[model samples]
Target: MTRRPYRDLVIFARGGGWGVDRAADGYDPVAVIRGTDFAAVRSGRTETVPRRWEKRTLIVPRRVRPGDVLLEISGGSVARGQTTGRSLFVGPDVLPAFELPVIPASFCRLVRFDTTLVDPRYAYYGLLDMYLSGRAGDYENQSTGISNFQFERFLDAELLRVPPMAEQRRIAGVLAALDDKIEINERVVTATEELLRAEFDALAVTGHGSVPVTELVEFNPRTPPPERAGAPYVDMAALPTHVAGIRSWSHRPPRGGSRFRNGDTLLARITPCLENGKTGYVDFLAPGQTATGSTEFIVLRARPGVPPQFPYFLARDERFRGHAVRKMAGSSGRQRVNAADAADFRISVPSPERLAVFGERAGAAFTHMAGLLAESRALQSLRDALLPELMAGRRIRPAPAPAVTGAATDDAGSSVYAQ
Candidate 1:
């Protein structure tokens, strides 16, 4: 093993992508992967696909290649979990798992590794160790107004410690085991949610009834949050931008965010955040208890007898999200959806008997999804706990057998674009 400059191992790297508004008529739904998408994938939440782009848009000249890793270079992406200056491997094993032709957006750099000099998988894991292990600060340059990672400087000066190919495979294998299970768990949650949506759509097709979202959901519901000592606070980061669940919450004064009780749906009202899919169901709190989150959230709770999870999937609707995005009003960057407009969203409602049945079935599915999320979280903790030690040539435990058989392979046949 020897330490070397990263530039010696990389063949080419650059950033380019057409604006979503600039996408013209074409059959290809060439997806421009932004910093948010990169962060979601890095967190093993690959199911959060951005629907901000037109699927019929033309493919741009800048596209992903096998072995190309998209690294977020600009913005506070590091704090957002994009891991500034880190490489997100887009190898054949990883790309096929996604739905569309995911090209790196303007804020990201596409780095195609020189496979002859470096094993792509190994290089990816090493970068993960560096970035996720909090070693990214040494390689990042946030001095400019924007947080632009100085990849060139890192390539020129940073010492990249590379192990032999055999060792790299072993290390990647061990880490991939934990990641594989996490990915599988994510797939299960995604599939189950899709099925529930399909069932909801079926109910709509049966001519059950149509009603304004307000009839079934209360917008901006009020709550008297507790003090910091006992309050459970959920920030925007605690909510997943793409996935269907909240990642974490804390006991902080519920002083600033919108308030809501259990079974409420929190949909981000701000620009880019709403467009990125930051909506979640509130089940972490007890029935009588309440929680607070970013003021940018619009809380929606089901009316009596309505399925608690129904509003969550309703907010997840493509048409509903489109309407919310269109109704956003304010400056270009600070736009937010008006709660009244959100309440005006129309959706189908099944007959009481049918709705009750759907509620029972959907509740079971959601409960199972939560279980999977919990399992994945625990597995992620184990992996994160072991990542640094394994990367540093120090083994905490005997390396397990390779987990690549199911790793990076999407067995569920989920669409590239989330449903």
Candidate 2:
């Protein structure tokens, strides 16, 4: 093992580009992963990654590959204590999520390690440790309210402890195993939700009757405030665009916000959020518990006799979303859809018997998804706890030979080796 300057192990490092919006004469479309998308992309959620056209010449050089790392070079919120040096490791499992060729966005840079000197996965863990330890913040420069990572300075000043190749692979393998499980869980949850959507679409085509949505769902229904001083509070940002589950929340004093109980759907009422498909199902709260959230939420709850999960699928329905979008009023950017307008929109309702059957299936799927999410959280906690100790060469000692497989493969059978 030896300590060396961080730059010594890097074979390539360059900032990314934001190509034109349209595919011009010499441009090809590519998926651009931005700093904001690091978490989603890492979790195998690629729907939010934007597509942009870039010159083939530029694309060839910036194209992302398995084993590379995407480093955020700009943009962070001081108030949130977020630094600009966060990174995402592009493992074999993450590449298939993109339909087009992938590249980091302008505010990010692609980093590739020298395989002979350090394992890319091991290098990534080192970078992650730096960020998690807040050491990355030491190299940040603030200007005009935006934080920028001083990449050159970081490379010159930081030192990394590199072990033998076999040891590097062993350490990386242990961490990757945890990540692989989390990724698999996410994929399963995504597939389950997609299946539910398909079932909902099928039912929509053969419903018993048509009626105003208000008859089935009560929008923004009034509810009594929680008695607890600090109740679970979900802000607008906690709402997910493509998934039904809300993964994050905080405890705060309830002070005049939309209040909802479990089994309710929270839809973003504001322009960009609504248009971007920001919605969530309230299933994280304890049984009979009520939570408060952003006033920008329009809570949708099923009426008696309706399926409890109906409002969530309805909120995600294309036709229902289009109606809500068309009903937007107020100023341009701040436009919002009225709760009454959304409630008045009509939809075909399945017979009570059929509804009950659909509910049984969808409810089971959601329960399974919730369980998977809980497991992922636990795995994440375990990974976080082990990361620092392993990186510091404590607790687990390096093996004489690699204790795991030489390469990690994704569901598509594509493989990424330690190199």
Candidate 3:
């Protein structure tokens, strides 16, 4: 393997900047991938990516294409130890999933690899390896509260191992196979949540009586905080919008935040977070365990006769969300909905028998989703562990085996074989 400066192997272009304007003449609507959307996009969830309008003159130059990597060069939290330089690879398959032309937002830069010198996917993996290994932090410069990536310095300072083209493709194929499987699992999770929401909506319409939401669910339910030190802690950022399961959490001393058991639903109460649909079901903890999270969370737990999954789906309901938004109090960006106000939200209650049936159906779907999430976590761990070694050429593996019955393939039509 030969090492070369990162700057020599790729071209960098700034992303676009323009407010969304649907009726603007001579403007084209394009989906803009922001830094906040990195996690979801990486996990194959693109529904949350925002659409903005850009001048037609600027569209062609900033337009994203397959094989390009969108690198976050700005806006990261210094307090959270999340440095800039997160990257997302746009593969051929990812483009078709978007309804509008996609481009990186103003905070990101488009990294285009010179195909003659290196493979794009391989280059992306190299960048990912750098970030995961914490090497990218070396090039981070923080001012005020926002952390920005010193892209030029990083490109000039860091060196990447250039493997042979065949070897590059082979390595990318193996890693992409794992990613593909994880993505497929994400799709199933999304589909399952959608199905549960549909069923819940149907039940809500056909059910007998109307009652206050407090009748079926307890808001900010009182639960003893975790007794032990370093309990699982979920921040507002960990909550997912469309997904039922929380993707990440940390172990920290319980310091007086909203505490809940495994069956509660955590909903973001603050302005942008609430508006962004940040709600997550609490099922990742061990049996009988309690966890604490950000004070901004309003925990929703089902009452005696109600199903555990009911509160989560209800929190996801459009009308319920609208009511919560309307109930928001406080000044400007800090506005939040109080638990008391949210508890006042009303819903139609179904019969006990019907509730039980819906519980069983929703519970099964949630169980399957949990299993899929577990599998994805395992796959992600494997990929993270293998990334550094593979990119550094420390681990030399054989080329992927030829496609057999039902084996997956990459965008280039090459067979994918897991290591």
Q: Of the candidates shown, which would achieve the greatest TM-score relative to the real structure?
A: 3
Superposed model 1: Cα runs more than 4 Å off: 19-30, 39-63, 77-83, 97-102, 142-144, 205-212, 286-288, 322-327, 345-348, 398-419
On residues 1-419, what C-alpha lDDT tens digit does candidate 1 reach at each position?
Answer: 58777788888777746445544555455556776576456444555555335434323445677777777777665455544665677745556767777777778888777777777766777677777766666666656556777778877875566777676676666667667777777777777877888887777722333666778778887666655566788877777755567868877755676888777889999988898788998877776787777888998888888889878877887778888898999988999988998776666766899889889998998888888787677667667766776666653533333222354333211111222
For candidate 2, the clash count comes to 0
CA lDDT, every model vs. true structure: 0.71, 0.84, 0.83
C-alpha root-mean-square deviation, each candidate: 6.9, 5.2, 3.9
Q: Tell how far residue 203 is off in model 2, in angstroms.
A: 1.9
Better of 1 and 2 by TM-score: 2
Model 3 vs truth, CA RMSD: 3.9
Worst 10 residues of 1 by lDDT: 410-419
lDDT of residue 125 for candidate 3? 90
Candidate 2 local lDDT, 133-235, one digit each (tens): 8999999998888999999999988778898888788778777877787777778898899888998888883243367788889999978788677889998
Point out the higher-scoring one by lDDT: 1 or 3: 3
- lDDT score of residue 103 within candidate 1: 70
State candidate 1's TM-score: 0.80
Clashes of each: 1, 0, 0
Instruction: Please rank every candidate by lDDT, starting with the best.
Output: 2, 3, 1
Give lDDT: candidate 3, residue 357.
91
